[model samples]
Target: MTQDPPRLSVTSQDVANHAGVSRSTVSSILNGKDARFPQETRDRVYAAATELGYRPSHAGRALAMGKSDIALLLMPNATFGPQLQEGIDSLAGVAATHGLTLMVRFADPDADETLRAILNLRPAVVVDLGVLDQAGRELVQAAGVRLVPQVINNESNEVDLLIGRMQVAEALSNGRRRLVYASLADWRLDPVGPIRLRGAEAEAASRGVDVTHIHVPLKAAGATEALAQVTAGSAERLAVCCYNDDVAIAILAAARQLRLAVPDEISVIGVDHTAIGQLVFPRLTSIAVDFAALMEALLRELDTNGYGPPARPDLRSSVRLVAGDTT
Candidate 1:
């Protein structure tokens, strides 16, 4: 049997002909340079392009504009939790409004190879979640591609710090003075754990509460062992601020095994406010990061750096305490 012929992609010239305008006019209007044109002409060009299902070719645009309309978000090698997923979704939504394509890539340990591949795409800017190494930064700079959240900014660490502060504040408000920071045992899985720990430490210091640091693995046995260290020789109530909900849940399980009463013997607060945290017994209290607000701030930063459009004016605090039985 004979297969159907492949359909050809619609082009700007086709849109121009359909709209009874020149190809240059179609290009200008579609590329957001239509201020000199009348509203009626701009409307005609947009309507024709939409009707014809025309999409600008990234390759062609790159040749004309020196870079493609792509915003690449470089994520560190870690578990993609609910909060991270929500931030990606929010970024994609905002990018669509600015006529930019959003792309995600897991950063490889070999920064050279990963960055080389990224440069091939000719992205307008490279945005990272604060995991880019010095080598990666040098390579991106050498290639002339913009890297967002410069070293001085430390915005990613600031967010982690906010999560840390929020977790400790919740525990403090519940009248738990003795504070413990439960960090993930694996550093590769949590590059930002140190920043969060610092935030917890800073908050605790301001309140005159000392925070002990402990590593808790995801497994039940490891978590139980860590909790034992916190409770040894001390009958005072403890508050544990976890790196994330998974870590918090693990501590909860350990507490159950040890027959410790939650929020009385020990209080737990987590970050991300994951769904599983709520499903467990004595539902977990967590710190919820408003990913939408974070995304808007990121977009605004990009716009200020001359890489994207202006972000919406509405912005609010990105972190809040979520009350639960655990805290």
Candidate 2:
């Protein structure tokens, strides 16, 4: 009796044959580089692959494509926590689909070692997370490495502010009149923290409301003392607009230590929409930013601005208000 063809793994070659195309064409379409193929041909390849149960193995595909697909990210003093790692993982997954690999490297904030390292690797794409200075940019140009500065400019600067404003809007929509702004006392986020605060303040002013701004450390110990006046004095509607969920949750912990009630006495809202926020006694209301889309936009820009030190690299993030018991 005839038996099934000797058990073997499926490859792009099988898909190519089924689609009446070369393996290279199948590779290009599967890798998301579909500009070369017409709409009908692209559809045919996708259908044939699905019918043949073809799955592309990422191993060694970068070299097979004859392209320099390595991407390096140098960010000094990065937290690399779950939230940040989620963003990094999204980037790695997207890059892998495009036959590229993304590597995140930690560098010293006080020295030029990061730039020196960048020069050594000569990656096809470099994402600088506010650590690279002017000299770093110049050296990257000299080394022929694509330098992408992750700075906010006219094109995408409002996104940072949008996060804060959304937090305030959520509070206001919940019938809360009094709002407070809580920012991290970190230098690394200089203009970013101030920018978001300013946006919240501006929106509050427009609505004829007053916002109390407070800067506190990352820890939860001293937060109670710093915010005791607001927590103790007000029986009125109150909410804290924290820089991120970390700070917001810290505020919650601090309030607990002071015997202050949440939602009843105060409501807390933060950005980042971290997963930890969900586990708290009262789920946190947060401004969720689409980090995957943000990275996708920046990476696509590399094709256009790949030659010189990267442009401001229009960084955009889609913000959404996630409702929870906190608000």
Candidate 3:
């Protein structure tokens, strides 16, 4: 090695030279503003940079720009947990590729407190996965900051209800009505439950079939009572569409208590398509929604500016008619 040509002091200028473009053009492309240039031209600059291993130090760029280049991710909970952690992981990967910092904040459900915490971060973009209520939306907007809401459940009117509603609709279509909806107390008013119920009602109305919809509070005693009604002899069919797999598993346990034969006498369905759904007896006929893809699209939307028209995802997951003994 002839000292590797003095290490070549690789810079944006070198990239411009290799790509036959101006230094300014290389700057724009490396700063994540390649939209200003044609795709071909952008590709050439990127390729030249890769060939040279030209890495622009993000910390140096932030210092020169008087900006932190950080992204703030906000969620509903008071702390980062598993679901929020997953979002952080995915978002962090995207941020690193773009040379940005990621800061996560959990909303305390108190508007003032949450708003203050978010504003302090001064993020280039804010992503909200936990904002659901009207007040929550208004609070974020009032912050005078760019915010992206990822309310998959009924937190906001914007996000899709693929998981909950689809599960309910599919369960009914499979002739598994006499449906019991079980939910933990916190999820009772969740938009998912009502939306799914609406879908079920619409389907039931169209078919002119009478289906019993029971709302059972999620608890051991309450599940016991609901199980009795579900397994009652008057009902020819029995199925439970739980708010989530946990509730469904609990109902399954309750069904066992009542000596009810699953799928033969009752079928159980659940939302979330969680691992518990698979581990349960007879497997479970569950609505499989792409939570990961949903999160990806959501972060992408948040990172971009000006609330461009919402784009629908090409990948759609349907609830599998998982033919377990329970239907």
Candidate 4:
């Protein structure tokens, strides 16, 4: 059997013909400038466009409106973990409801080159998750593209602090007094590790609990060395709040090699609540961030900054503790 040719994309002209309106009318109605037109005409245009699966070309819109309906998500130069993936997926869904196309790009260290290429697309907004540098900000501002979370201040650190607080709270609930913050050895992979450490320290301090800090690499040897440091110079039971599930798992394995009883001698809590955390020998207690709620807060922030449409003001705390065998 012969394969059939691909169906051509439906265009504005097709929608206009189907709706019994001129191309200009279809364009105006689809672009949300339908107030001058009759409600019936607007309904017809929308219904026809939907029926024909018509998608307006971003290039055409950019030419006409000076900016495409693209929301560029600038990701940090780090490992893409489950939390980041889930956040991206959630943002894409949220952005679509605002008639925006979501595009993700790993933020390159070469701010000039990265911004130069991003500005070429003429994105309506560039959303950064705590990665854009001073140079990148200047470039995006010069290009006149709206950047979300405009201030680029310490507000983003609140999320990391929340994670830290949740982890420490869960560890304390398990009756582990000696608290320790386990950060990743690679600084580039953990830009917010220090903020998280601070949060843990603050929380622990409030309860009159002192927390030691240790850096653990992903490798077995590094984890073993870190575990040694964690257990050194103390006989009291310890609780470790890890940067992520991977780091927590590494510690779990190191504990097994050291023959340390989890939650008895060393309670572990992690972030991201990854699936593998549940699959491990002793299920890893982790922090689960409500990415949908987080994205909604972000969208609302953008709206408040006059970058997008108004969103519901139902922002809630996104951090929660997932109970498991480890804690």
Estimate the lDDT of model 3: 0.60
- As a TM-score, model 4 comes out at 0.79
State the number of backbone clashes in model 4: 0
Enumerate residue pairs that collide in model 2.
none
> Cα lDDT of all candidates, in order?
0.79, 0.71, 0.60, 0.79
Provide the TM-score for each candidate, comma-separated.
0.79, 0.69, 0.65, 0.79
Q: List the candidate 3 regions with Cα displacement exceeding 4 Å.
A: 1-68, 78-88, 130-144, 149-160, 173-176, 187-191, 209-219, 229-233, 302-304, 315-323
Candidate 4, residues 1-327, lDDT tens digits: the string is 975442346777889899998876776677665677899999999999888878778887788778897888887777545776677776766565565768888767776667777878899888877677777787787777877766665665688877777778888985747888898887464577878898898888888899889988999988999989768787888899998898999999889888889979989998888889989979889988777677667765555557445554433367778889998
The TM-score, computed over Cα atoms with residue i paired to residue i, of candidate 3 is: 0.65
- The alpha-carbon lDDT assigned to residue 188 of candidate 2 equals 58
Between prediction 1 and prediction 3, the one with superior TM-score is: 1
Order the candidate numbers by lDDT, best to worst: 1, 4, 2, 3
| Candidate 1 weakest ten by summed lDDT | 307-316
Candidates in descending TM-score order: 1, 4, 2, 3
> Model 2, 203-289: lDDT tens per residue?
888788999988766777767766776767666767789888878888888888877677777888888778899888789988887
